[model samples]
Structure formats: C-alpha cells, structure tokens
Target: MRKLTLLFSILLVSLVSAQTLQDSITFNPQQQLNAAQRILSGNYGKAVTVGAYGEVTYNQPEALNGELDIQRLVLLFGYKFNEKTQFVTEVEFEHVQEVFIEQAFVNYNVAPNVNLRGGLMLVPFGIINEFHEPTTFNGVERPSVDNVIVPTTWREIGFGVSGKLNNLSLGYQAYVFNGFQSTSFDGEGGVNGVLKGSNGLRSGRQKAIQSTIDSPTLSMKLDYYGISGLRLGLSGYFGDTQAEDDVEEIDGANIGISMIGLDARYAYQRFTARGQYVHGSLSGTEDYNNLTGKDLGSELQGWYLEAAYNLLPQEKTQRLFAFARYEQYDTHAGTDGALARNDAYNRNDLTTGLSYHLAPGVVLKGDYQFRDNAVSGGEVANRLNFGIGVWF
Candidate 1:
C-alpha cells in the first residue's frame, strides 16, 4: 500500500507539472501559434495515468459451490499525440492472478461530430455497458440481466464512431472477431460453460479445434440530455455468431441477437433518480450434418429492467453520498420463434446498495443482492458485497 501511494503521488506531481507547462505555453498568442507549428512539425504530446479498484463479497451459498471471493482489479494507461488523436488501454486482473487485456484502442477525431477509431473498443450500449464503474451507475454491481444478455464490456477487434450534436450523442461499432464457444450442449451454467476460444491467429490451437468460430457483430447507442437534470439514452446490438467443428458440418448454426435499451436519470442538488431497461434476443439453428441427421439444442432469449433512487440531503459538507438500486431480470421474456424449446431456463435478481464518496476520485460501496434461478430447481440465495473504486 505504501508503494502504491508513492507511485500515485509521483503521478500527481507529473500531471500538475505538465498542466503548468501547457498553461504557460498557451498564455501568449504567439506562443500558441508556435505550439501549433511545433505540433505540425511532428512534435507529440503524451500523458501517463493510472487507475485501480477492488471488490469483496460474501454469499449464503458458500458451502454449496458458491464461495464469496475478495478478488477484482483493473488498471489503465493512456496517451495522446494531439487533440485529434489518442490511444487508451486497460488490463484487468480478476480472481487475483488471472490477467487479461481488457481494451486497447487508437482514436482519431476526424471532426467534432465524427471519429474513426479502430482496435478493440467497448461495444457502445446502454449506460454502464462500456465503462462499468460502480459509482458511474446505480447498482452495487452491474445488472445480472445486462451481464448475460448484453454482456458488459463486450469488445472485439473493431472500429466505430462517436460524437455529439446539440443535446444528442451517438456511437457505433462493428467488428469480425472470435465468438463464444459452447462447452456443453445443454447451454446454461457456469462461466467455463460459456468460455470463448482464442483466435487461431494467436496460437496453433486453430488446427486442432474444430469448434472454433468467428462472429460478425455491431452495436449503436445514442444519448440525449435536452432537459436540465434529465438525461436519456438507448442502445442496440446485432450479431451472427457460430462455432465450427470438423467432425460435423454445423452449417447455418449462426446466432442472431437484437437488443433495445433505455435509461433515464434526473439529478438536482443531492437527490437523483435513475432507471434502465434492456431487452435482448439470442437465437440460432442447431445443425450438424456430419452427425448423421442430428439437429439439437434450443434457441435462447432474455431481458431485464432496473431502477434506482439516490438520496443525498443538501446543505451537507462531508465527502459522502448514498444511493440504492433495484434490479430484475428474465432469461426468457417472450417464448416466440424457436426460443420456446429453451423455456425451462429462467432467472430473476434483486439488489440494493449504498455508496460513499471518500474523495473527488474515490468511492466506497456496499450492497446486498438476491438471486433466484427458478429453472435450476435451486433455492434463492443472498449475497453481500463491498468495495473501493477509483479513477484518474
């Protein structure tokens, strides 16, 4: 912890010094022109930043294969060459030792209303779908409904555009990247049960894995804040995903997804009201020609809705804030099309939480969640969680 604090202090000093130099350079009109000339002459501006967070939870099903773990961390660094171009990336260490590159992307701002960004980037969707900060949203944790259906932080090697016009902001992304893999034919369980295989371009596993596949995906989101203390947004995504197997030609085994999301928030002084709704669909045909006339597995679909209210009394001078959120989800909203076959899988979740703002860039939070897997023939369980979050 002392080392971390020392590193943070050094970073703070660097940022302050850079800001001071920039201000001084821009103070004079001629210096400003010279600065522009220097940039046009290939001079580059850069920055180094850091961020971290942690979470711990306790659950009632600790003895039933569900142990509450105190594990979760994410760090990021970013740099910019000019006002029109930049790069940002993050590395997430979950479960303590498992490290993965969460995101890495280069952005070019072509115009105030248009940008051409490539590399891996968050699939722009509803509010917290991309940047999953605890305080940025209302819940103690992300909505379970959004997690499985829309898949938060869902990103792939893709390009997209984002900008604002008047009170409306729009963003879009599309890519061709590795898709999800199914470990079991039954289709609904653990994270390993939904594991995704790496692309062949990275390793030789491509030749031995027949179930490896790549999917085409796209997402779009729009945000509008036309009224004071009120902001609203919507997002949607579509994709055709599949898995390949050499033993069986699982042709036309493509998946199609459709999502509709809505969010509204009102903030005045210390009081805030927010709510969100995301509806999604997952469908595909199970065809294995090499399996000798074998076509099994069922189509999937799900949706969920959530709401929260933040109570912050005015006239307070402490560095603290409190909030609570209520969430609910349904794995099968409507059993139409080919989704009726998977009607046996359904779940619901409810959560409530509180948060404290210890400083301008730090937050402490705690919450309780109740989940019911109605189809798993299991009883409902309660979970308690607490964590500290930070960003810079």
Candidate 2:
C-alpha cells in the first residue's frame, strides 16, 4: 500500500506538469512538443501502441460447466499523418477463433472545437458501447442490459463530426450499413434469440463480412459531459430490416426497425453511479410474423443501475472497490398475436462484486451474478465469476 501511494503521488505530479506543458503548447507549436510529440519525438509523427486483454470464468448452476478460455485479444494500430489527421484501427480475436475488425477510422482535427471522423466505428450510446475497455468498468461481466439493449462493441460503417465547446460535448454520426438479417432470428433461449426477442438483437449483426443490404440503416447519437462527474446521453437507430428483396411480403409489407436509448453517469468523491435505458420497436411485425411463422416480438426494452465506491481515500493507483448492480430486460417485451410473450424473454439480474486495481488500467475482478426469469421448468441462473483484465 505504501508503494502504491507513492506511485500515485508521482503520477499526479506528472499529470500536473503535463497539463502545464499543454497550456504552453498553443504559444509555440513549431518549437515545443504537444502531448503526442512528447511520446514519440523521433518517429516522424508516426506512432503505434498495442494492448491485449481477456477473461476466464467458471459457473456452477445446476449441471452447467466451468471453462477457462481466452475471451478477447486485440491490437490497436494508430498513425499520425500530421498535426490535424490520424488513422486508428482495432483488430480483435474473440474466443480465440473469431476474428473481427472492431474499429478502423481516420480522425481529422479540423479546428479547436470541431473534428471529422470516418470509416468503421463503434456507436456511442450507453457508457459501455464505446469505452468498454475491461479496466474502465466494474463487474467481471458487463451489464446484461448493455449487452442486450445498447449492444456493447456495436460498430458499423459510417462517418460523422464530433466537437466540444467548453463543458459541452456534441457528436453526430450517420452510418450507411447493412441492417439486421432476418435469417438469424430464432425462438431459442440463452443467447441465441438475437432476432427472436429471446436474447435481444445481437445475432442480427452482419459484421461487414459478405453482408447483404436491401435498405441501409441510419444511426445517430448525441451526448453531454458538461459537468464534472456527470454525463448524459441519447442515441437512436432507424432502418428497414429486410435483408432480402425476394422474401414473400404480405400486402407489400415489411418491417422498419427503430431503437432509442438514454443513459447517465455521476460520481461524487468516493461514490459513483451509472445507469442506462433502451427501448426498441419494430414495424409490420404482425404481417411479417404471419408470413414467416417466426414468433418475433415487436417491442424490446432493458435497463440497469450500478453504484460503487473506493476503499482508499484520495488514492488513484491501487485500491479495492465494492459494487452492486440491478438489471431488468426483455427482448420480447411484446408479441404480435396468438402467441404470448415468452416468459424467458424477461430477465432480472443482481450482481455484487469487488474490483482491485494494481494500476490504473490493470485489475482483478470477481463478482456473483443472480439471474431469474419466469420460464417454466427453467432453473434460475446464478453463478460466481472472477477474472483479470488490462489495458494500456
């Protein structure tokens, strides 16, 4: 603990010095180093940083299995073209077998207050949607509501402008990307119901791999961070979901999908709180259900609230923190007809955990998850999980 405190003091002092240097950069950019130049003085304005993190877990519920696996491995590549432009990309390996290009974009600092960014990018909605590096958030597993509603790691092909004025931050991104593919919809339970409203809208992702698009979608996000320790946001998505032109349509009817989200975060001293709510609606579901014979829900919604506190005071390096979270979500909030909404669609989650950080971006995680649903003959899924993650 003594060593940790000393390290934190040194870091704090360095940060103050850096801030002072930043204030001086504006007066003499041609002769002095900015934040980026200080890090790579002889690299010809080109620089790259790499990071990797993963999780291993065990679950004991009924006869469920325990497994140790590399959950996520990633490499981030960045290059500065000049003072105004840079290229960034993230190459990811999931479960060690799945490969994904999570992000690839070029950001241009057009002015002191405005910037333009383009290419495949992560959508900004809830807190986790964009800044979900493991060390940055609480809990061994991410909040279920974010996974099912806001859809963590959600990315698409598009471009937009991001800017800030004093305390207010604003961003606009419009993506022309393939909408959900209807083929992925199924009425299964436990993570398979991405389109069927049983597991939310996850499986519908096209991931830009030989994707098909009949009508592309437009997604937008607007957020604020105008106050210290407080953040507020709103985001939405709209598009036609029909992936095939030849699918049989009832009276020339098809479904257009829409989703809206609201989220907030606040912290005071040692106490921190965060929450998010997202709701989705589907159009022409009755006709589409009749034609496809798949029990698809027209409505989906989910929400979660979390709070945490640190055990050490005025310390930023190493400290243990306790947290608790409550989550409720239903991918199948409502159905078309004749079929009642599946009880399994609704889930209630309670989690309590402790996180200990050895460094700012490296930590050990442990948590217990208690999950309940109204499914007939289905046992409640409650388990304990622990893991470690890092970022730099």
- lDDT tens digits, residue span 17-135, model 1: 44312221111111222211122222234454334445554444433554566556665555566788767666666776676666677778798666677766666666555546543
Model number with the top lDDT: 2
RMSD in angstroms, all models? 9.1, 9.2
Q: TM-score, each model?
A: 0.70, 0.81
Q: Over the stretch 135-254, how does candidate 2's per-residue lDDT look in tens digits?
A: 667888888888876677777766777655655454444455556666432334211212555655676676666665777677777766656667777888888764444442333235
Where does model 2 exceed 4 Å of error?
A: 1-46, 167-176, 184-194, 248-254, 376-378
C-alpha lDDT score of every prediction, in listed order: 0.50, 0.67
Candidate 2's TM-score: 0.81
